[model samples]
Target: MADLAQSAERFRVIARGKLADPRIQSAIDSSTDRLRSHRVDAWDELGEVEERRSRAYEIRMRAIRDIDGNLERFRTALEARGGHVAVCATAEEANAYVVDVCKRHGAKLVAKSKSMATEEIGLNEALEAAGVTSVETDLGEYVLQLENEHPVHIVAPAIEKTKEDVARIFSKEEGVEVPPVLEEVTASARRQLRQVFFDADVGVTGANFVVAETGTVVTVTNEGNGRLVASLPKVHVVITGIERVVERLDDLPHLLSLLGRSATGQRLTSYTHLVTGPRREGEEDGPEEIHVVFLENGRRNLLDTKYEEMLACIRCGSCLNVCPVYRKTAGEAYGPVYSGPMGAVLTPLLVGIDQAPSLPHASSLCGACTEACPVKIPLHELLLELRRDLVDEHETSWFERLGFSLWSFAWSTTFGYRLSSALARFGHRWASRFGPGRVWASDRELPAFAKKRFRDSR
Candidate 1:
């Protein structure tokens, strides 16, 4: 993927195509609206949403501030319970570790639940290259996997796919006719995945929160796939970012209370699996071996920086629900793994500003994401900071720099300001007819310059 700052024409073409598709537009709008409305109602029911958000923010910040110590403590605790821990500092190391694990166990088939961490590292592609068949058990993820696509929303992976689309995908996969009915499509998926659960040599999942105090790996899910994937296979591996750790188990209630409501409007999800370790000696059923891979992947670089607050994010997807840019273009416009307001800030941070120079400019700076965040991350403010960083580093194009410099020079003096204003007023009629103005006016009406100044009248 070429940097959009350098490939503006190509990026605009892709964005325009997505915007022109009515089905894509309708799907994104409906899904985000519903989730946004649900979150508001859920917060209203809580009656203490602000208080809970503040507490959650504090808990997350504390852990991030001392992330090295927290991760060390977590490692010791998990190791005490006979669980193994691997701290990977890059995507390559993480992928290599997971592949080595599969090779060591002689595993051929792996069952996976919804995990954005795995998506970030391209775990599925790595597994396939290593000759492992990784099956997605989550319905939305399964649909996306079959469609050869990645998730669009953090919570709703296949939010753009309708029942009819799903039926077509399922029919192709099953080698049979399937109706577009919800129940039938669901049954068809269940039938195909049931054997996968029994036959998979390993199961992989992502953690919602990791308790440093107890070394518990917590996963929240609406579907029951998370529990099955963890318990059914002989080996269970957890892949997650190091920022997910909280200093204490006591912090769970505050964070958990807001996660479901903010993400999906449920007071709590159907399953909140807290796995301490592998199955005990007398356990009837559970994975015999448990492994936790904590991925840094540029997360450590944010510590002690101005953008450190971003680590407090809990993947609630509340910000994405309210982001105007995301609702219009979806996740593909941002990147493959993360999208929306949080993605706009985190992507550039994780991947370096030079590589993704255009992401910081993806937002409208409306501050809705900050207001909707469960942990109170100032998302819009961080985006503005990123833009400043880009300017300081000279990553922006020469055209942009010249335009801004000219504007600043003009506005800094009364004579230049008056002259520019006069030019703008006189040129207003032709502004929408060509160049950048033409493109801006393609979808939106160009604002008209006022004929008279209020200061003169005063």
Candidate 2:
């Protein structure tokens, strides 16, 4: 919510907290390793994945290129199927749309799946502010709700917290002592959420991929919370970014195949729900009203540009697991809903570089994120582009301008570059003697420069 550059000091502090905590280290390492293995297993199951991944990437790119056309088609399809569609240009607009719908229907309580888009728009908070009680039905989200914290991982929001931590949180919630057994703790949350589901007046969710042909919104989750969140409530509201739409119904199976494989290392998540619209005539049990909110929220600017490819992201969060920075700081450091490399690029663009410019610079430019991306988003390259935008286009601080000026000067000329290289080489001895790199030193090791330059050695 705050400018990340201005908040850089705060982020450094958050990073320090994360770095100092041994529990965070262990939790991140253990969970990421397991996710890594799952991804490998999933990929192995989908052998010939390179070809499949490539095809998936092409489909998304084409869909993005003609996004306006596809979006119109999607809206038409949904309207034809009796779904109410609203286009929101900002998070505020989307939140307002949802709130108005809830108020009009006199919703007292709402149950939600893990909708990062809603989190991005602060939907639950908005509803709470409006005196409408909203419950997070996802197990991970339920834990976060009790703790009053944001999601740490896109896929597993509470990944940073262990069973012991969850048990303690639940103990506080139930007003009783609880043990650290995961199954017992999880079951307790499920029982409570099931009750909430039965009484919910509304259901809110995010679409994984929206099919333009059928005007269908699809959500994949392991816990089956999405099904309850979308099916039980009298009114169902789905929020999603404009980029999620694909060209046709057939393209969905291909993109979804890539999605399941990339996330959770599963051939398929336990539950995948696809809804075309509200329940039609003769429908047994379904929401009486269905609303689809298509949010632009700063995505249109990337169109016809190099960064447009980022729209292909399915939010599998594979990039977060492999991200060196995200591994330590976790998702909160991004100061936004989306985290990791995808967050690094998307946050600055959506929230504005002026609001959170440092996000783009947060990456170590490690290609692991790019490699892990199922849709082939060039995350590393996007970081460089953001850096360029920050320096040249955005209103940057004096220190950054001076630093880049000197950096550019040294890079352009042979003499300046060579001289700086020599000085850097000579400064190696003083590196440790100099002020502690405290921030950089925590996450990585810096090499000491040698005294002799390569050109001067001969």
Tens digit per residue, CA lDDT, model 2, 1-458: 12223354555767778888999989998998789779978898778867887898899999999998898899899999889988899888998899999999999999999988888888888999889999998999988888788887889898998899988888888887778997889777866777998999999999998988889999999999899889988899999999989989889878777788778887788898999989888988779889999989788988887788888888988999898888888777787477889988888877667777678778889799998998888999999998888778745778658767897989899989988887776664565454553434645667766556678889
Model 1: per-residue Cα lDDT over 76-165, one tens digit each: 999999999999998889989989999999999999999999998999989999999999999999999998898888899898898999
Clash pairs, candidate 1, are none
- lDDT of each candidate versus the true structure: 0.90, 0.84
Off by over 4 Å in 2: 1-6, 394-419, 431-446, 456-458
Every model's Cα RMSD, please? 1.9, 2.4
